[model samples]
Target: MSFKVAIIGRPNVGKSTLFNRLAGRKLALVDDTPGVTRDRRSHAAKLYDLHFEVIDTAGFEDAAPSTLQGRMRAQTEIAIQEADLIFFMVDAKAGLLPDDTTFAGIVRKSGKPVVLIANKAEARGAQGGMLEAWELGLGEPVPFSAEHGVGLPDLRDAVVEALGADRVFGEEDEDDGEIAASDVLIGEDIADPDAEEVPAYDENKPMRIAVVGRPNAGKSTMINALIGEERLLTGPEAGITRDSISVDWQWRGRPMKLFDTAGMRRKSRVQEKLERMSVQDGLHAVRFAEIVIIVLDATIPFEKQDLQIADLIIREGRAPVIAFNKWDLIDHPQAVLAELREKTERLLPQVRGIQAVPVSAETGRGLDKLMEAVVRTHRVWNSRVSTGKLNRWLETILAHHPPPAVAGRRLKIKYLTQAKTRPPGFVVSCSRPDAVPQSYVRYLTNSLREAFDMPGVPIRMALRTSDNPFAGRAKKRT
Candidate 1:
């Protein structure tokens, strides 16, 4: 079994800060599920070559045993039970409160080796709490300022001592041995640890897919249906999701990291910091995603924020696919789909070739088609075209359509080359580059997208006047 280390403490005690410090990446997908982490956040963590699984759990509060807070408390307790060692963190500046006494008793009884961590200890003011941590009866406290990057070596040593030198590697446990950090965490995850190590079929890493749109748009239902489990908190609440939560899984043998974000609305009435932060966090998910699935309510598909979100994704350089979710709820499905397409074509011309997959996320109606689009778009994003073939294609297209006349002059379209891919962009050299008409540019772009069978991927073409290859030749004038 992989060794597990759980960090437990009250809220705002730097537990998350310490977690981020050790994990070295803020990969946590924060959402509506407050403390008592909705899912076990595990990552490979190492100390001086000793690799193990580090679990950042929700903190426990000393509240009545039957409330929602108590249930959250139970979740943390479960983490404590599973941990090989428990780092009972405390706010060094807050000193010891009655609640700390209540929680200390709970941790003391677990019998698992407890490492008392004094976070925010950089301030001399924390001396009182540093001393108070000793009173928890978990032996000498290991003072650590998780934010200031203080006392890491000592902390590592404390871990070794508690876990034992033999247990440092999982060999001491049974059926497991020296592990790399990723090995430990990825093992418990849904995706194969080998999928990451092995030569997977796809070159692209798990594409970050975000399901976003207005509230009650079946975003959660779609994700649950996709994963075949109720992983997110779904309800009738308009904005049930307060934070973005990501689940790692595989689809058709391709590893994927999917994020389900809170429904985004306009900021006209948003008045709270916590709410604003939640919205911003959701947008951040969209910004990080490779393909954002804008889940729209079938009844009222595209709203102001929906268009805004789609525009933002394009601006962020991420491919977008629209899922008109709750298709079953629509009266005239085909007509509505057609209308939506026409509207999207007009309002969002910048994202020229985006796919609009009409399906009910509730019934798993069109997921296969959705996946097909995602894979197809991703392939387009990673596609590379040879220069020789590209120039040949360009020659045929230019001859067929021809550049439009600029004033009395017939503009000449010259050689072409692809500058980038991932949306497969191209640069075309021409005479009087700026003289190329907008209609001609659109025609060329549409032709490229259609010819390449690149349905949903963004295609970019730029015109530049080429410098004469012999411009630098010395004059032979007498």
Candidate 2:
């Protein structure tokens, strides 16, 4: 098992900045505002030769448990409990405070080994504060600058001495040449350029599905239901989740990674810079995921923002499945479901046959149907057709409704072939690629979807003029 290290500190003390440095990438959201990180996020990290898992947690506060800040502190406490080692960070420039001393006592009571990191030591006035950090009684403070790469080697030595180099490097020499899930690049569903056809997805790899919706739409609650744990902080508060948290689990023996993202609201309403960053982070998760589950409040389903979110999913070429959440709250289930289905078709014609499952995350009603729909949608998203079959279908489509005349010259579609899958894309060779009306393209797209039974996933078709070998030579002679 990998060793776990958690960074705990008061808000805006550069805990997230240190985490991003250790992870070798910016995994956590960092800002000047206090309490920006409300969830404890963990990622695989390496420090020179030492490899371990590092967790970045919410800043500790002294609010009541009923309040949001208190809940955030509760999460931090949980992180302290789970960590095999802790990096109790203090702002070197701001000097030691009473909260640092208090939290140091809490970490001391936990009985875990700790490394004191006096961050921002590069600042001109940080020397006195770094000296004061010793009063916390954790250990000797390592003057560190998380932003400027100062004292990293000393910090690494401290970690090695505390955890033991053997503990840090255990099992690393066992060479299997296997790639970890973290090492796999994002957008793994895209086609391999060297392969003749879009290859089948490796079942061993975890499927990444991002759950997104407006604020208080039960995304985190639904994820908790699916994973059977309250791993995320949840309550009556809107936007309790501020980061895109990814949880790994197995469903009926299939490995899956579920990303619980911060709720996204309208652009006009998102005036705060922190909320804007949260929304952008959620959008990034959608791009990285192969499938997106858009949760909607069943009571007031298909709001304007909900439609915009769905359209965004389709535009991203991700397999989309609608979860009509809070189903148990509905007074008339049958009628509401019927009306919602009608609205889905009318509002989302791009994904003509999108699957919408009514589920109550609170009660676990219809969870199985939701997963079933997800699996079906994923299969369709990766669907592929042979060139011959696509050309034959194209012929039938053209016979039914040929391309419209452009300037009294008839357009001819020469051939059709699928370029890739994972939200299937096709290339059409035609006489006049630019003259193909978008309406006609829509007709062919709909027809293709109906014929191939590909519903809910975006289908991309590119028009290209067929190559003429002698056209340039003839023009030169003339």
Candidate 3:
């Protein structure tokens, strides 16, 4: 129930200072150099019991027409457009510059309310620079010194006024300016390493699932059946869904967010701006998603683009469940299901052992099974396997099928350990990492998948040469 606010201004205008002040932490590095921050940084914060998310962005400064800065400016504009509120800061001590006037015009066009802050107010008086700020046409400025911790209350009051009274943030406590509510999550996710306690995420927690696929693959139809409401705008047009929308629902009473993506077409074919934006927006949904359910048109399943998209999910370390949509279209042959399974196995070998369910988004066929696939794959994504058990499995794998002969020498894989697990990435120390063929790497990966019962999960194995397997060996032969 928290809202998001962004601190934006021209470079070196104490925007980062204001961010660090409101955040109550030194998350953003303060430096005299302008444009130090190149990317958008988001953090949770509290301003007088009004708990919310805040974004510290790269300060905008005019560049040589169209350069990297210009592209980054586009990203900044997008962030400003997305945020609920903005803190348009200007250095009162330095006075308004020409670029500031230019930026003021840009902010005015955003159509979102802005809180203009005359920063560096403690340097002298707000008289001179505050007068200069009047020409920007936003409104009267809230002069404050971020470094000196001044004028924060006026900033807080401005936010409450903009958000209104029927609010999630009731009021600030009379004592320490913290929210009096039990539900609010306080402080940024970042904290001091020595005394900080992080909020742990529950993997058992119901995650947002997205069903992304090509046109008429039953995205709208599937959601309609899942929620028992024809909520999505579905039509016969190839790319009718120009927006990726989310719906809240539950699986066995557990909360979930489901995103239905538009039909992705070839880059050469996407003519309209809406289509291009829809594709980009759909990709964003994929990145935010915990488990991405890739709905496929079963008639032409595992097309090059579908495979590429599925690979992209695995590459991003996201758990994916392939849903063969329009399953009802295919008539049942004597071994049609078996044939489909084989096709999936061969075409998308990268996501080996992953579930590929057959379902019709139109008729809600196999949705129960689809949810089961989603839950299972999600569990596998957040899964962590013990190093000892993994090493033992690796031992068995190496014993059964030793590495291929290279230069008339059989390479011995000395040890294997699960270094990290998001998709269960493993590091195997061997005689020669480069000499190990892709087929052999595939062999070990396939073996690990079967041994761990890790169906619907991507397995990653990397080969590296160990300097010494017997580093501390002594003469103990008996």
Q: Best lDDT goes to which candidate?
A: 2
| C-alpha local distance difference test of each model | 0.73, 0.87, 0.74
Model 3, C-alpha of 44: deviation from truth (Å):
12
How far off is model 3, as Cα RMSD? 11.8
Tens-digit per-residue lDDT, 19-63, candidate 3: 777767655656776665544556557777677777777778787
Q: Which pairs in model 2 have colliding backbones?
A: none
RMSD of each: 7.1, 2.7, 11.8
TM-score of 1: 0.78
Error of 1 at 60 (Å): 3.1
- lDDT for 320 in candidate 1 is 80
Cα lDDT of model 1 overall?
0.73
| Alpha-carbon lDDT of model 3 | 0.74
Give stretches of model 1 more than 4 Å off: 26-40, 61-83, 98-113, 134-139, 170-206, 214-221, 229-245, 267-288, 326-342, 358-365, 470-478
**TM-scores vs. true structure, each candidate:** 0.78, 0.94, 0.58
- Encode model 1's per-residue lDDT on 112-149: one tens digit a residue: 99888888888878898899888788877888887678
Ranking by TM-score: 2, 1, 3
Q: Under the 3 Å rule for N, CA and C atoms, how many clashes does model 3 have?
A: 1
